[model samples]
Target: MSTPSGNGDQTRRDIQQTRAELGETVAALTAKTDVKTRARTKATTAVGGLRGRVTEAGQSAKTRATQLARTVSQKASQRVTSVRQKSQHTVGAIQGSAKASAQTAGKAESSVVTSARAMSTRIGSSVRTKPLPVLAVTGAAATLAVITYRRRRFR
Candidate 1:
């Protein structure tokens, strides 16, 4: 009779422990099913994802901007170098033309001087050879010049 009573008491304790475990599991499941809490967790996850995407976009834009700036800078440098080279070439051409013109002018001046000197020598020799005839011709030329000048002034 005493052994049966002890077995009955042990069975009652086991049932109580099982009931306690079941209650805990039900509480845990109810908490998991709470709509507000689940919504809040989902919202938090979405915000974190959005933040990560925004950071990635910002980094990508920065990289593209840096690359564009480098490209523009390289183009500007090339243009500057090209313009400088062209200007140097133009200046060299102008200098060469100026030097050639100066040389041509110097040669023309020498030619004119030589021709004038030769003409002057010929006239002086001709005058000394026939002084009387030269004087008569000179007087006749002076009289004709006076008559032509008077006619133009009257008209």
Candidate 2:
């Protein structure tokens, strides 16, 4: 069987619990009614998110720029090396050509010198052996040159 005292005690406990729940509901309503505070909170949260995105984007751009710089630097170095190699090859070719030309000139010069010496010896011997014939030939050569010159001048 139920006792009247037990029932009364249970009713008081229920009333107290209902009052506590009502107070919590009123506090929640008051907080919702505070428009300025709610707006500030929302704006603060939005600004925090925007800052995070901005930071990430800035870092990404910086990384891309660094990569581009490195690429440009590497390409420039490669171009320099290529030009250096080509110039070296060209210089080597020129040096070889110069050496060959010098050798050919030396040979030609020596040949000319030898021919001149032989001609000088022959002319000396001929002059010693036949002075009269040499003088007559020289006089004839001079006369022929003067006649050829006069013809050209008159023309």
Candidate 3:
């Protein structure tokens, strides 16, 4: 049978019923507290295991990184030392080459000076013998070269 109650009274009754159900549910949960505890314990153990694995992985990575860094540093140092030795040898070779070139240049200069003086003496003797003919020939050659250069330039 439907109760003849106002809407506000019906709402209060529904609220009271929900509160009673909630009380019973709380009692049931209280009784199963041990089960909840066990579930929580299992979850805690799983999380601890994951934490251990993560810590171990981090440590392993750190050790490997340190080893790789050391190896790279050692190799780089060795390469630098090798390059330094090679540069030293190259510098020594360049110095030796420069010294040899200087000596050769000095010898060539001395030879040129001696040859120039000897040629000057020979020219003086030749001028005494046939000065006029040599001067005329030189003038003719110079004029011919100048005329040829002008013709080529115009063309």
Candidate 4:
């Protein structure tokens, strides 16, 4: 029932503080000694971080693939457009060439027809001017042709 001294109260407080500090140290040591729990915790954290990284990488790759596909499509479209333009130009050139060739052929055919008609007129004039010699030569040629035709037919 006697009142405690001031020094005794201070000592008691110090002892309680020491006991609290000891308890904290013991708890820290117990946590460190528990290897299985620490390892399990570390493994869970590593797995979570790795999963996040993998997911991020996958998303990045998907984005790149989409960009690549778009690039290829655009290039293909450009190439197609270029080919179409070139083909159109080539077709136009070919048509122009064909038209020029047709015109030249028409001119040549007209010249040939004119030459044939001129030769026919000259032959007619000659026959009319020399009737007796022409008849005699014609008679000789007809006789020779008949004789040759008979020989060929018999063979």
Candidate 5:
């Protein structure tokens, strides 16, 4: 009876040892799996953060480009408007100068006509009263005066 009881005691001790080793292995494997899961989650979050930053940078660049283009177009339109206004003013000035020149020409023509009538009347009176030699000399002097007056008037 004493020998059988010692064998039973040894067998029970070996079974208990095996169970303890199996429990330790399972705990270790569970801890490693938990650590790996945390590392993978952290990496995924970092990638998402980088993606968000890149998207924001792209949107900001597009907004700036649109604003710059609008500003350039507005400035160009203003410059074109300014040029158009200057051209219109120049055209108006030219028209005014032409009208004034036409008026001056009409006045000069009227003066020339009056001078021609006066010269004709004086020549007729001189021809009626003068002696033949005096009339010939008067006619030659009148002809030279008329020629000089016409040259000056036209100029």
Candidate 6:
């Protein structure tokens, strides 16, 4: 009879302790479910997500700009190289034309000199062989020159 009474008392104590722990758990759950606290937590999570997206967008824009700059720089370099090659080709053509023209001019000058020398030799030989006839032809040419000069002056 005494043992049964003690067991009954201990069971009541255990039940009371369990009831107190359950009450504390319910209170904690109620605080966690408050509307203001839940809204604040959600807002903090949303802001963190937005910030991460913005950072990602900024990095993407920077990478695209860098790629575009490199492409533009490469194109400019290629254009410069093309222009330089074209200019070199044009200069080569001009130099070749100048050399050919110089050669032609040299040939023409040589031909003229040779013809003049031949004509001088022929004239010298004719003068030595026939001085009288040459003097008579000279007199006639002098008379014609005087007549032409007088006609121009009268006009």
Over 33-98, each residue of candidate 5 has an lDDT whose tens digit, in order, gives 897887988999999999999999978865775565455555555655664675576556555555
Task: Give lDDT: candidate 1, residue 53.
Answer: 100
- Across 37-77, the per-residue lDDT of candidate 4 in tens digits comes to 99999999999999999999978965775565555555555
> Which window of 10 residues has the lowest lDDT sum in candidate 6?
132-141
Residue 115 CA error for candidate 3 (Å)? 31
Q: Candidate 4 — what's its lDDT?
A: 0.68
Evaluate residue 138 in candidate 5 and report its C-alpha lDDT on the 0 to 100 scale.
Answer: 51
Model 4 CA deviation exceeding 4 Å by range? 1-4, 101-155
lDDT score, candidate 1, position 65? 56
Clash pairs, model 6 backbone: none
**Per-residue lDDT of 3 in model 1:** 75
Where is the poorest 10-residue window by lDDT in model 2?
132-141
Task: Please give, for residues 28-80, the per-residue lDDT of candidate 6 as tens digits.
Answer: 99988898989999999999999999999978965775565555555555655
Q: Order of candidates by TM-score, top first? A: 1, 2, 4, 6, 3, 5
lDDT of each: 0.68, 0.69, 0.67, 0.68, 0.66, 0.68
State the lDDT of candidate 3 residue by residue for 105-124, as single tens digits. 75555555555565556657
Better of 2 and 6 by lDDT: 2
Return the top candidate by TM-score.
1
Each candidate's TM vs. the true structure?
0.57, 0.56, 0.45, 0.56, 0.39, 0.52
For residue 40, give model 6's deviation from the true position in Å.
Answer: 1.1
Predict model 6's lDDT versus the native: 0.68
Model 4 TM-score (2 dp): 0.56
For residues 1-155, could you state the per-residue lDDT of candidate 2 as single tens digits? 76799898999999999999999999999999999999999999999999999999978965775565555555555655664675576556555655665577755555555555665576577558856544544544555565567569869
For model 3, the local distance difference test gives 0.67
What is candidate 5's CA lDDT for residue 145? 67
lDDT agreement of model 1 with the native: 0.68
Deviating ranges (above 4 Å) for candidate 6: 1-5, 98-155
For residue 32, give model 2's deviation from the true position in Å: 1.1
